[model samples]
Target: MRNMGGEQVEEAVASAVALLRTATERDWETTPAGRLEWTCRYTAEHVAGDLIAYAGQLAGRATKAYVPFEITLDEGTGNEDVLQVIETTGALLAATLRTTPREVRAFHPYPYRSANREGFAALGVAEVFLHTHDIAAGLGLAYEAPAGLCADVLARIFPHVQPGADPWRTLLWATGRGDLPGRAPVTEWRWRNNLVVPAERLTLQGVTPAAATDLAAGGDGGFAWVEGGPFQGTRDAAGMLLKAYGAGVHRPEWGVFVLVRGEDGRAVGGMGFHGPPDEDGRVEIGYDLVEAARGNGYATEGLRALSAWALEREEVTSVFATTDPDNTASQAVIVRAGFARVAGEDSGSAEGAEGAEQFAYELRG
Candidate 1:
């Protein structure tokens, strides 16, 4: 539900691979996107290739920002190559940790608004930690993430670290969350959406669950989160999220659901419903979209719809959300969704992750 573990990330990819495999025998070539996105086999190959490519980056002569190097997903190359890339890269980083003096600084080519010289260093540490851990998970192998080894990098980065600030923000002038550079960072986690919609335009009417579909018909240019409709999830899951919103739960108390639909009618993203609809109808909201579909007005739309749905109940008084202060995009969405800042929150260390600082927002009776 939070930071993915190696086992979870691997399970997710395995599921995706299974679906892709079944579709293959049927002669289906499209990715989950339903388009001629990378073929099923190449899709796995590319994922492996992408990892190798990242490892190659850390291994290359260019330590500073540079164009990404290429890695082949050729059939001739076995998965062993992908594993080797990871292991080899791990060895190099380990050596760097043991030998390189902390003062000799280096950087990679990637964007993270929150990433400064110090924050970037944390990101570098996170990069190696996350990717190495994830690849092993994907391959049913085990490995250790010596975050302690890069203690110098962490120390430099930790000071500049604002709670909830992801590595990308530190690395790039850009804001919002997305994938990292030179690494596949996840442990059995299905990467979710990175929506960062503006809050100014978050109007109740504009975010009805069905708005995305209607807009596609009218050809509106802005962004919005459409309903992924009803969904089912593993028991470990609270509701219809994390698995592309598969259908199952549709209780009236569930309120509504939505996805981030681009200008096209296709639902490429999703989020909404903070909890079970209360007797008074109070409920919070959330959204998850893809890497490509971020920074549009989707999160705002989802918030609007959740509010609209809750407001329908006269007994309902308000709704709220907690987010990282550095996650300005999410905060913006919260404000625009008809909630207001009312209180402070505590964002503690990794142990008290949920304790991090949060802004409280509420709607009137």
Candidate 2:
């Protein structure tokens, strides 16, 4: 997947500003922005404010809440001046994205409490694209963002939304800004940033569908991996994640997570659930580490953290795993993570011949 970062933000801001400039002489203060109660002028200001706010979030390294501040234009600012503010703020956000570390996360309250640099960049682009569309609609002007840019934003932040034939329209519909064939109009929506869980020596970074697609296609999934890392199992898991996303049943938190080392920010392994908890409140997990990263207990620490995170949820009563009988290293990792080996029917041995040959383990809440 393409990295939707500073360049994309700059591109989006430029496109929006160029188009809005055409209508600067029009009555923006009185014209309502499409589907929004705010007027075109106010909406333009909002776009600028969001851009700067995202920049602030990343630059300040805020973890608990928003940096309590807001931008206000000078009294009697003109439409052209508003556009200038948008440009300035967009540049600020782009610069911030370029400098923020990959592992750094800051406050953002949507489905998750924090967002990384890419997440903030995606949000910045989304704000510019959607709100620019609104302003264009109100002014009776034409506007459409680049299809690739639209797809990039969707894959990163709108992972829950099934991709449509037209990414731009899908984005519009997903945000309650437009409609689609055979699908009910969206009345409420919130973009989701991928989840991150911290362990003793690693962070389990949730893989977005975009990253999953790239990884499945032999790409790096935007992670810096240790040499000989992201083994075949990680790619296979990413393929499974893409399949679930295509089916519109992929719950991001239940999808694949790349194990990133805290000290150097390099991905060392992959670990995640097969899916959400079943009706019996049991969720199965799988994991693997690169040969170069193994024997250091990274897998054990990651498994312990991820399993505990899952078990803490009200719907999950047990976390399950199964390993090949000959894979003693993996068995040790599981054992170290507090999973107990199980036998008989409770071990899922009756499921099939395959199940009987593997060692089943469970960590109960």
Candidate 3:
């Protein structure tokens, strides 16, 4: 995806700065910050510290661990000074994001051990919005981040959480800070970064919800594509992803992924599962290559890699696909990936057999 990093970071900081500016004269040191053990003063400093730390990680490109350093307020610094620090540190992060390359990844231990500039930006924004709420709630001042900003952060970092009509409230609930109707209150949570699988000549980069939304709207989905590529099938897959996500049943691991060329990082195709494995331990898979990238075996490589990954999971015992009977090229690609064509009875079909012209293929664990 195109990494809306710099823009998100700046918007989050501006929101916090505006809210905190009104309460600068209050006694922040002794006022407890919501449910936290620390006071409002400490929470404000924490925001600044995180902004600067993320900027440092991106700027230094630390791959193994966090760069061992810290930011501290000067002795006798007041609440106003802390807010200034936040603004300054936030700007630093924004600048760092602008300079960082789109493909550059740094250390961040979550579901994955590394994150790109976009991930860090989303993380930084989450901190600002959540903590600013804590301070605002404690001080009895009203605060609400923009709905669009909340959606961006949730799409980028909180992909596992189902979206709601009110993005701000849903975000707070997902992070254990608030509650939503008909849902259990969150006591603990962790954000998930999208997963990427590597093939011999291509990388199956997982599509984030943000990218899916864009692609569904006929945009480029933040990927650099080879000329005249990202064919209709890829966009259809993206639309499916968005529908599943909107319904709150989307699983990131089972979602669509862009086939990015290893040599140049230009996207050449798309591949993914239809959904999680069904009761019978079977998952349907799909793929498509850009016209310019066709006949290069990219589809076969990606299919093999994704199918293998799915079979590695305990829930998936088999991977299956279907292609038009006349599309011999697609049939050959599936066969080359080690799938056996199911016999003419249409017995292996996932959807009940209504059309006899569609050939079914399967690969067992």
Best by lDDT: 2
lDDT of 3 by residue, 130-158 (tens): 99999998898999998988888899888
Q: In every candidate, how many clashes are there?
A: 33, 0, 1
- List TM-score per model, in order: 0.31, 0.97, 0.93
Q: In model 1, how large is the Cα lDDT of residue 279?
A: 65
Best TM-score goes to which candidate? 2
Candidate 2 Cα outliers beyond 4 Å, as residue runs:
346-356
Model 2 poorest 10 in a row by lDDT: 347-356
Candidate 1 global lDDT: 0.38
| Better structure of 1 and 3 per lDDT | 3
Better of 1 and 2 by TM-score: 2
For candidate 1, give the lDDT of residue 214.
30
lDDT of each: 0.38, 0.93, 0.89
CA RMSD (A), model 3: 2.2
Query: Candidate 1: lDDT of 260?
Result: 30
Off by over 4 Å in 3: 1-3, 344-356
